[model samples]
Target: MYIRERRRFVAMSLAAITLGACAETSVRPRQLAGADPARGRDAAERVVCAACHEIPGIAWPRGRMGGSLAGFGGRPLIAGRLPNQPDILVRWVRDAPSLIPGTGMPPQDLSPAEARDVAAFLYTLE
Candidate 1:
């Protein structure tokens, strides 16, 4: 099953890349250059992102309400509303409703650095 899923992911990734879904835009370094994916992974656990998001590496929680972030890095948009770029992701992580009024996601208390770390980790899902 794992092999099958991996193959499916590869096929979908190829399709997305062919269709320009994963193209780097003017807003680049989508994962935040110099930010630490390892630290971000740790921060994700501390921040309890897994409480709402089904993050890639974290095992517990497996939240159903906020939806899975399985392939979020390759996705073209954030919250199906905004372009999925680094700055936008950082802002979204800091405060989701500010970016889009009435967004289901609530504002988080992470510092700017922590937000960057979380964004960095999230972008690794691709």
Candidate 2:
């Protein structure tokens, strides 16, 4: 009976360890506060962004004039200048030329809310 009890205790301990491991590794995608990725995707489509660059999960066009927008969340900078933060991203999206004169990226007419959504979607690219 002692041997059976020891085996049962070991099994329970192992099960607990397994569950803890799963909890530690179960990570979900990052989300920006007050930003909607779905709305951002829709905005991208409406703006014809694919005509100049390749954005993941946004198929069609996929022009080569600009860099691909994959893995943007991991990137250190946006437009190779500004910090890759939500506020900076929103400003850049709304008016790239204003931020950096003569920038190839044209000023998009997206409102602050729309820019926020786009920034949120970009943050999910990791």
Candidate 3:
């Protein structure tokens, strides 16, 4: 009985570890480090992001000029061009026009840290 219980415990532990690893991989480290989704949401609101794109959590000043931010995290590409990574996403948020010339998404006045927070919030959209 002791051996059986020990085996079961080990199996459960392995399963838990595997699940945790999966969860961690889904979100990049940059998005996880010192990133606050709540603050990102607030930043989005302050920056009037909803004025162009329809954000899932924020429900105000929604506009149709930009693509909906729904499922943004799951997307494989940013701006339908760059890879969907934390660094790339942050840069895109900070200066979309710089990354992609003529992008309708105007450059934001957000600082680097603010952009990271925004990226964290966006990563939660999945």
lDDT of 3 by residue, 4-92 (tens): 99999999999997676555546543355888989998999899999999999999978989979998888767877876778778999
* Candidate 3, poorest ten consecutive residues by summed lDDT: 21-30
- Consecutive 10-residue window with the lowest summed lDDT within model 2: 22-31
Query: What is the lDDT, from 0 to 100, of the residue 38 in candidate 2?
Result: 89
Candidate 1 regions with alpha-carbon error over 4 angstroms:
1-31
Q: How close is every model to the real structure, measured as TM-score? A: 0.75, 0.73, 0.75
Instruction: Rank candidates by lDDT, best first.
Output: 3, 1, 2
Please identify model 2 stretches exceeding 4 Å from their true place: 1-31
Residue 101's lDDT within candidate 2 is 97
Candidate 1 local lDDT, residue 36: 84
lDDT of residue 49 for candidate 1 = 79
Among residues 3 or more apart in sequence or in different chains, the pairs in candidate 2 whose N, CA or C atoms overlap within 3 Å are: none
lDDT top scorer:
3
Q: Candidate 1: minimum summed lDDT over ten consecutive residues — where? A: 20-29
Please give, for residues 4-111, the per-residue lDDT of candidate 2 as tens digits.
Answer: 999999999999976754453233443457889889988988888889889999989898887898998777678887656666778887888888899999988788
Q: Which portions of model 3 miss their true places by more than 4 Å?
A: 1-30
lDDT (Cα) of model 1: 0.82
